[model samples]
Target: MGPHIKGKIKKTLSSLAGQSAQSLFPDLFQNESAKAESSTVIVPPPPDMNWLAHADFGEQQKRADSAPPALLALGGKPQQELIAQKLARMGYVVTTASSTAQALERLSANKYRLVFCGADAAFEEVLRFVNRLTTDQRRHIYFVLVGADLHTFYDLEALALSANLVINTRDLPSLELILIKGLRDYEQLFRPLLDILGSTP
Candidate 1:
């Protein structure tokens, strides 16, 4: 090709390359003023989960402090009266039920911290009810099984029965002392766990 023609062709090619570059990447050709006028992205901060947890814990603590702990005594009239008197002495608001159906109805109506079921009085059904409770609900209740044959304060028997304590019917006279001892042991075992979970009983 002639020198003049070659020079013209090269100039035309350079002009086309610059136009193609501008079309492919328009941002690259933007003026400094235009770039400065673009909007800035603003991100919202994350939610404060710790604050929510603390608020929930505070509300539970207030409710616990305001109410007397509730106790459900299920069995014969004589035994129920004895349990009621003994637990009331310890500041519990005791409710009595003569049968398993009555006991289940009471349980559904209110949240009881303590539950004493006579082993000879529909104990199996009550035990099943306790067993089927949610983990959160089960941990909050202190279940006691009272029977003529149960060994009082026997850890193995209590564990087998899924009860917090097992009390002999003969020891109903000492129900106060036995319940105090059982509560102390229960607190020692569960306080740390409840603290870790940030739950109140």
Candidate 2:
């Protein structure tokens, strides 16, 4: 309360801090005040209890599901650009690739929440491509094949093999509207491609 008592309290605290560092960090405290000049916060490891674990899990799921994730477009087309920009406006981060080779390079470097590939990029290429990526730790990119020329441009087997959705480049708005309503509703049109990307293992 008074100056003398305040000084005594400060002194006691200083001594206690020194003793704490000496006990916890040991020889690292050889410099004492030099290291002591740094302030620290002690956050102990979380308890192994399930309630604490559940709380953390709930927090993480809340964060992940709340925000729109990044998107990658693996083909160079005006439609892809327009669609990606539209998605970006809707709060998704978008990156585009001009070809399968470029897409491969981009895939190596970044993890996208979704991928929209030009439908013509060969089924084997997409399959072999994604197959190579599966062993990597963070391979959660959802693949969607994009093109309106499905009759002439679609690869049924390849679309079935690697993509999660087969979206007509022209149907971007309809797809978004459909997705807002329910992902299951749009799964019919997009299923062959969507299944490959959505399936685990």
Candidate 3:
């Protein structure tokens, strides 16, 4: 509290410095300071991981580009799933859209070789979307309308509806065969046009 006591304390602390009592005042002792510095755990910087993510993305993109062409199956869940399964088994990537808006969005975002509109779908809206597509855009897609009132493979009805094929819902059990036959005819009918346009699916 007084100058004399303070001087005594400073002298005692100075004496304890660099001595075995250095442990009592590490900041005042050079050995303790060096020891404290040496004992500090130095953490290494993290490794660069951005390249790994970029590499994975690139691989996935490559696989998607090289994979089979995609098709859209628009309908109720049951019909959409059944059609998707059949198309997938036939070596095509099938995307399902439960509503007209969803189907339109999918069509606008991606190129689909085929579009199967089910009886439950909003036919007028889907047809309007297809009708609005430019010739160049429309030519690449094979549109099919599936409904109970439609006759399977009815060229006249298909023409009226601007569809490549029309299938009766009752004939859905044989969809795979019908699709094979219809797609064969479609390719034969459009190969020349597609070739001229410089785009073939």
Give per-model TM-scores. 0.64, 0.47, 0.62
In angstroms, the error of model 3 at 88 is 0.8
Residue by residue across 39-83, what tens digits does model 2's lDDT show?
A: 566544422223222222322222223345554444556786667
Using alpha carbons, what is the TM-score of model 3?
0.62
What C-alpha lDDT do the candidate models reach, one value each? 0.74, 0.53, 0.71
> Can you rank all candidates by TM-score, best first?
1, 3, 2
**Candidate 2: misplaced stretches above 4 Å?**
1-71, 122-127, 135-139, 151-159, 178-201
lDDT of 3 by residue, 67-168 (tens): 355555455645667767777766677777767788878888888877888644465787888899998888877888888788777687788789998887
How does model 1 fare in lDDT?
0.74
| TM-score, predicted candidate 1 vs. hidden true structure | 0.64
Leading candidate by TM-score = 1
Error of 2 at 46 (Å): 50
Residue range with the least summed lDDT across 10 consecutive positions in model 1: 56-65
**Candidate 2 has what TM-score?**
0.47
Better of 1 and 2 by lDDT: 1
